[model samples]
Target: MTAKKELLGSLLFAWGANSYGQLGLGHKEDVLLPVRVTQGLASIGNIKCLVGGGGHSAIITDDRTIWTCGSNAFGQLGLPQHLGESTLPLPIKTLNGKAVEIAAGLRHALAVTAEKGLVFQWGVGMKSLANRGLQTLPVPAFMSAREPCEVPGFGHVKVKHVSAGAYHSACITDQGWLFVWGSNKYGQLLSSDDFLPLPFFIQPHHFEGEKITLVRSGWTHIVARTERGQVYTWGRADYGQLGRKIKSTQDSMCKSNVIQSRFTPEKVPELTGASQITCGSEHSLAAVGDSILSWGWNEHGMCGDGTEVNISEPRQISFFRNYIPAAIGTGAGHSMVLCRSAGQSGGDFKACPEEQAVCQGNPETATT
Candidate 1:
């Protein structure tokens, strides 16, 4: 018998802010409703992964190729030329057979390969050899040392996951340990130093002996989840991105709720049993069973509560009721929710709203 592997669902949809064409809708406009983005991919097996950063979106084909769009301001798109941006999906040829998963930051991207667990990175501050003086590129170059380069200090261990924040990056090892490097401004890397020049293992006081199952970073914050779903958040919280609220001990008339930032990983008492978690510039999204919860900066409705209120408390998005979210993600000012119709055992999607605010590809090609 021929060999077979598990496949991911095919119902890819995007919505919310698209100022930089991060939605890949062929135009720079915000989408208030869900729009299909599975174009030109049915012929190439299943689309396994989707990732969003400050102003970019990416997808990985089941065949292990990468396609990206949106802002290439710092060569994050891995293109041969920095044409500002692309409103349509363009292939990143350099990562073809090399990446198993993609992680992105505000101005950078990381390709995680299982082979020796190598990580190839591009974008701002990625050229740093000693992790000190780094430069940013405004134009895209070929995917070589000038564009994409393998991380030197982390080739010894096998990384199973990778994540990128604004100026820093992180990865989880097969043994469930977390390693990070890059700018530690705001203490996002949990190090007192300014720049990490190289990847270093982080042993958070809160995670004394627990194994980390997943780790994600935002513009200036980082969150890690243990195998049992316990979550710890740290870093910039000026926008309440740490899922924490400040304490006010002033007199009754002078009391005010102050949002504070954290420099150490503190367990968020409200979150548990999260199967998946993702972070935006100042917001966060997590999945628990069929329910999805959000918190932090909601300036542009990235919280998806149909409101633009910055909150530190976790709130559930009722719109996803009765829907089984297969995957959830966040962008700088947007959110992407991929769900399969409830009651369907497979990755089959149900009918979505019919309205052509702006169209790309054949909508008829999406399966229900």
Candidate 2:
């Protein structure tokens, strides 16, 4: 399949498995071809931003509107009640007004808002690493069917951006602080082992010094890019997701559970100048200026090089050197990118007016 995509006049491209019309290509068949997703709803000109998970998709319009399709097993689509699955991008109710950015995980959703000035989550609910329990999540602060508040000390925190791991969550707020919660089994929660709190907000020592620029959460590890162009990682190092090989040196100065398990945030050996970031099921991808870097699992070419060999440490993905990447998105096992262009708009092709607008171009960075 020719998966090369160019940003031109607001166009949307669909490739890979499409069993649920999640590809929005009119049918429920896998798409080995680069088909345009211009359909009944998207034609009105929305051309909003688009993100894809394992088998689901999310689209946000320029007007702060949100739409979702595909699997809803855990209410990841933010629909009123569980709808099972969707064949195409469907408008989500009450999701408008002041949305700045949106992110998706294997079965969860996250968003940053203006008025609320915070991060919100909903979906499969992240499981607890200590208690080993599962709960539904709504984002900025953990939620239930009744209340949604702040993350303890992070009260009324205005989020700058948000990201999600397979079962965890991360965020950077306007206060120049990074807060992580949900699922810390492998220390993906970036906290001490014994200090298990119910979706409590804790700051990582590695995030000190300068303010952060961007943050990306992966399945088991999390990476962040700062204004200084330095990339930092924490959480789950069993697979070398921290971008360096470590001999598993976890020290628990605090917390009683430290005796049983050691969970501590450590810095990646030698990585710098990251311009963009994204994460897959168990691997990671980033751009240092124009250099593409991949780390962690590469079983299915998820590393984006040309090999299936896993990269426990960092490796250069020297595929798109000449092009400067603008944006990035990752699915359960694949990745997508957007390149900056001159007067080019990723064309919109949906059937309805509400779905019409300027759509974010899906980078053909391919599953590699």
Candidate 3:
């Protein structure tokens, strides 16, 4: 009679702009409400994903280990060296546990390794402030790894998923192909080469054949999702974040009509079936079916629609309607929703100003 291994924890909750503490909730302020986050993440057993970057926050758990927290400056929390900031949650241990999938950006961070998926990357690489016309400022064209290296040529290329925006990085090859590398500025790596540096596949007739299972990144924009559920999108359409709409093209070298910025990929017919998708820094989210759909840069509401205004297309949030989402996250402004109560089994996290504030718990007592 020896059977009792049901751990599987949950219940993490966090809120908008945690300054540099990145909401691990130990300090650095800015949370605005929903807090929990349990210090350095209790014992770290269940959380399989929760990434929020720009200030930093990783966590990958399920024992595959990763757990970072708040700005390591340019090292992007791969840890080691001088240790700039960490509002708690440490554990990088050289990714020995195997880290399944991870992504974070605006400083940089990426991972993916469960044996052959092998990806890993580290901070600071940007450069291409929109072809240097943003009027200056945007340096560090390379600093790739301060710690967890291994992003060579993909060895044999197994990578399942990986994304990091603001600066750039992407992966997705289990067969679905997709690749991509750093900073194409607003084109988000559809590549006119503002700064590609390495990994660059992205061509299966521009996804018209349908394969990519999922992909996400924003700060510049990109939202993939195809296996039939459709959804495409491409980089920085000003503030509308490419949720569809931005199509003025007559500039055969400036004959005149040029609104540009999407650069390539389009689709997003309203996010087709969207099972789940995320991005923030400019805003984007999708869950569909039970409903969750949002669009670009809602000022500070992060597209919750209570109106800070930006949203160009999608829109359906109405507070999750009744709750069923399961998981979805985004940062750089804030948005997180791990739901449950449709019939109830216990799980509800929510964030992003759905009014007064709610962060209830009980993921089986929030294990430790």
Candidate 4:
């Protein structure tokens, strides 16, 4: 019998603000164009996970090893405090086990191990009475070690997937239950402004029977998708990042009046059938069919909709209506998109649609 050989050919590229060299381009130079990242990680096997945060980047390879770069002021890179910052990807040590999944936020990082269903975290976003006097950890720490640790108000549960936000964290349990912790000032934790020192289960029968499949957090907002293809959002909506319009009834006397912000999870309209979702610091993107829909803050043209205005409702970007996006990543002030020709396989990559005539030839790559 002949053995089957696996082939993996994935490329990683990045752009936007490189003030911290988070793009891993070997320099802290910002580029308006996407450049292929090919340093330090050229020898790594297939990339299993690639995520970008405010000023740092992280990736997990098929070999189950974790690599990180950029700002480490709060040890978001999982390296020791004395190591300082890095412009190139470096392996993280002292992890209990091989990392299967990883997530990064503005000032914190989280990783899930393959064996024992363990989760580890580091950085300063997390707050608690025990560490009240301290600021932030310059090294990684255990959130749940060998055995499961019961959350203060919520019962004990094993986490299957997790996401770290700017000042909060979220996780989905093996039972499809969702829990959150950390700063809830903007109600990003789906409750009061009181900071939750421990994980708390979000109550609401709306997600009772649904199997939570995916959850992503922005700087101060969250986007969750279920097994049934339903999307829900909560937290800051000052820039319409929640994909809903604002309705104010109070008088203009309150100039600093708050707009619409969901203290609880609310379903976002027009994103019912999305398959994948990613969030920037204040913007979000979702993939449905062959098109990409984006909304929220776009002051830097991060929405990629050919406009600098903020989007309050989900709208498909006509440029990508024909080309299907394979993956998407976002950072504090930029967006990255990877695409492949829809309905075409192998080497059938072609030029973009005629409407976007500016791109007349088969481009070297597809990214924003």
Cα displacement (angstroms), candidate 4, residue 199, comes to 1.1
Residues 126-240 of candidate 3 have per-residue lDDT tens digits of 5334335333544333344656776767887687778888877787776778888766757777767677666899887887876776778887788887666677887767678
Model 3 is weakest, by summed lDDT over 10 consecutive residues, at: 354-363
Per-residue lDDT of 1-368 in model 4, one digit per residue for the tens? 10001112334446566788777778887755445566754355555556677888777765677888788876778777435678888887768787756677787777766665466777654544225423463211343221112233323555666677887778766666777777776767766535666667776475555766677888889988666667888778878788976544556654344434365567886988665577777888777755778899877666776567999899887666655654566676566655544554421112222111111110122110
What is the lDDT for 325 in model 3? 64
Q: Model 1, which residues run further than 4 Å from truth?
A: 1-10, 33-45, 125-146, 246-261, 348-368
Rank list by lDDT:
1, 3, 4, 2
By TM-score, who's the top model here? Answer: 1
- Candidate that would win on lDDT: 1
The positional error of residue 126 in candidate 1, measured at the CA in angstroms, is: 5.8
> To one decimal, what is the Cα RMSD in angstroms of model 4 from the true structure?
8.2
Model 3 ranges with Cα > 4 A deviation: 1-91, 94-102, 105-142, 146-163, 166-182, 185-216, 219-241, 247-256, 261-277, 280-290, 294-322, 329-338, 351-368
Report the lDDT tens digits of candidate 1 across residue range 106-178: 8788887746668788776344422333334222221223255677766567776788888788887777788
Between the candidate structures 1 and 3, which one is better when assessed by TM-score? 1
Q: Local distance difference test, per candidate?
A: 0.68, 0.55, 0.67, 0.63
Q: Write the per-residue lDDT of candidate 2 for residues 1-368, one digit (tens) a residue.
A: 11112223433444445555555445667643234456722453343355666666666665666777777766777785645677767766655345656777766777766576566666654533323443242233343311112334445666666777776767776655667666666766656553233445555446566665566777767777555555667666555566764443266445444322224444554557554566776777665545667788665565667676778877776655544454444566555444433233432121221221112111121000
Q: Worst ten-residue run, lDDT, model 2?
A: 359-368
Number of backbone collisions per candidate: 2, 36, 0, 0
Ranking by TM-score: 1, 4, 2, 3
